[model samples]
Target: MSEALLIAVLALPAVGAAAAFFPDRAGRLFGTVLAALAFVASLLLGAYSQPASWFAYTPAAQGAPPIVPWTSVDTPWVPALDLRLHFGVDGVSYPLVVLTTLLTLLCCLYTLWHVPTGGRGSTLVALLLVVEVGMLGTFLALDLVLFFVFFEVVLLPMYAVIAGWGGERRRHAARKFALYTLFGSVLLLVGVFTVVAAAGTADLVTLTSGSVSLTRNTQLAAFALLAIAFAVKSPLWPLHTWLPDAHTQAPTVGSVLLAGVLLKMGTYGLIRVAVGVAPEGARWASPLLGALAVAAILVGCLVCLAQTELKRLIAYSSVGHMGFVLLGVATLTATGIQAALIGNVAHGIITGLLFFLAGAVKDRFHTGDLAVLGGLRERSPWLSGLLAFAAIASLGLPGLAGFWGEAFAVVAAFERGGAGWVTLGVLAAIGGALTAAYFLRMLRKVTHGAASPAVAAPPLPALRVSGMELVAWSPLVVLALLVGLVPAVVLGLSAAPVQSLVEAVTP
Candidate 1:
């Protein structure tokens, strides 16, 4: 385990994306096979890779640590500006990297089974592989400039996926999504430069692992820039307007990955970049962040109650679920950060399942409007049951993956109360209750009652759940239950890393 494994993990997908330009049949096969290969390579990297420095300039001061060496590939690219081509994974980012690969693999499988209308399967699969590379790179990049490059790499492919292969208003949604995220990327770039300039280095590990420090003003300014950038990506509260449109218009695979992996990048950035590099700033701004988190929770639930479209409803639900994760970050404590990490993974699994089910329902009944769809249980009990199960999981039902993150977040807030965090905790609890209310409302409207004319219309084939759908969704379902029953699976991985983060803030 050297850099060979990490290089293979990234290169295989890039190669796959390029190969997907072949003839349609061959391209699709190559895409899926290559994505599977990349996923395996990532797993191997997780298991066998050791801390190694691919390239680094020795520091002037004796006994100082190099730019990279902690399960990373580090190579000098711009010594004058202190930039490096660096990639690494620690406990905090490892699970997310794995989740990205897993979800991309599943999306490829789903694409093979049911290619979305209005696009070539090969193109969609190729774009998905590219997105995987960007996501994995974001999670693993150990230098701020390198991280920003990977972060921006995801933008174009996702925009094309939406605009080229989406529903009505696709272009508008794609443009909005692109513009919003691009604006954030600008802020992120500026913030990265500000931090690098202030700290005299661009290595994320060096700055964040507490080797560098900045003045209070620099910390505050940089964190402000970075937080706004991350917030737009997180789509917190008012800034979150782009998410519903994007999710509603995007194709099934697009929606799944958007909700599953893309959104986590924002919250993860808050933890890794904003707090990790600007601890004092994080403490200074924690109150405002906490308030916004509560606002997102409440606002999302209220919107979910009013949403008629299934995908739109699920999209709004993400805002609320992510609020818990953000609140955990705002708490800036180990327990809270662990909750944030678990919540991030749980949201990926549970919301990915919800989006898949929503897509399946839309495909069958040809409508996602709650008023026009009902009695799915009578015709497609399995699909209906899965939808119900996903809804329960989303509602934070006990013994499911969604439960622990939300519960722990509230507990952390209550324990770490100050400057209205207690109020934030109470409001979050209400959001959780509202989460149940709207989910139950959705189930009642779409899963129960008399079959509306659309559902009962004659000549409609009784659509059974497809094998590919099961293959894509079953892992999420099982993982949700597994994590719920034994949260240590996720929490255990992030605990040590999050504790380190907590110390950064506390010290």
Candidate 2:
């Protein structure tokens, strides 16, 4: 039954992608329903994947394999290359899988009401479903070769979404986004084959479990290649130039998914693949990784402080937010990994809503320039309130979803101990302050004071929030509060798997 659910979670989105081309509104309606069903399947998969014995299960013996999927489907796909149709769900991946489905569903529902000008709503929905399939497959794939296949699958569909349904500069943004990620894809391909060839197996479970021994040199090389590849996707530091452009020009749903689950792919792979597959490499590179992560935090916040465009500010914020996630992973401790995991989920929730609100602002005012927007509270109280809530949540308010991840990442870095790690931790905490400053700056400019020309130009009635917007934004708002208040929602599920992985990797 669990296996069937796993298969269904994947199949539903795929079917929706095909059905989404079936004529007019019917296609969109069908797609939304299918997305909803896919989300339901993901939730059920989580429920079923939990062990029946739960508290009674014992830890694996020392030097034994750590990866034990609660539910998995293993079958031969290509006997010649030793590749198999291997997929599984466990504590580590389940939350991300569920996140992908939920975000896709919200995006689809948003599309049903307001299709961007560049293409048909049906096509946009179809492409979203395709992206969903790739993301879910990435999270669920347990074979190294298969993981690469799914990872590559996301590039074109997302490109189509941006290029076909995006803003004035969409084509250039789409092209740059594709080219940067494709470069990373090449590195990823080389890294995957390197590990597979050296280890004589493509099974991620086998490779990560310490059953296959890789020399230090090979592990170092593979980890570097994989880390850079994932970093490009995470858009870490110098490699992140493409992201602001992509987000600035992408349609609302495109920005949401890009910031939401798409970026998580990189950080997720860094943890599950790079760190898990090459612990020695991770240890060797920890200082460098942590340093770059803090750099991203500070740089992203500084850029956001100077940003003039609304969407662009939000885009830059993702860089800093993801920096926190990466910093947590760089620590290489159970607490750090747990912080990274919850941070991943919290960023998805808060940033997704921010993009949604940014899109609404752009759509209504016909401008995203912070200099030209003001007095949101006077013209549209509810919209202003939602924007305020999203911005506050994004700035890492103590009781909001964004708080735990950033705060814990700092705590984890301190927990690691050492002058350099301690410095990185202090700098990251300062970045947290910078985060609050920029977000508050954004809110004051966009929501308070006298009305700017752009804000005053839009009729008050026109600024009123639509029902469709409410439906799309409500879940994100609730999730920000829920996850913030009860961080255990993500942490509880991941604790054991994270402990096992940390133990396996620790010298």
Best by TM-score: 2
Alpha carbon deviation, residue 195, candidate 1 (Å): 0.5
Write down the worst ten-residue block by lDDT for model 1. 52-61
Candidate 1, residues 121-216, lDDT tens digits: the string is: 898899999999999888888888988999999999999999998999999999999999999999999999899888988888789867787999
> Which pairs of residues clash in candidate 2, taking residues 3 or more apart in a chain or in different chains?
none
Rate residue 30 of model 1 by lDDT. Answer: 88
For each candidate, what is the lDDT? 0.87, 0.91
CA shift at 464, candidate 2, in angstroms? 1.3
Q: Please name the candidate that would achieve the greatest lDDT relative to the true structure.
A: 2
What are the candidates' C-alpha RMSDs? 4.4, 1.7
- lDDT per residue for candidate 2 within 239-278, as digits (tens), equals 9999999999999999999999999999989999999999
Off by over 4 Å in 1: 50-70, 458-462
Candidate 2 displacement at residue 486 in angstroms: 0.6
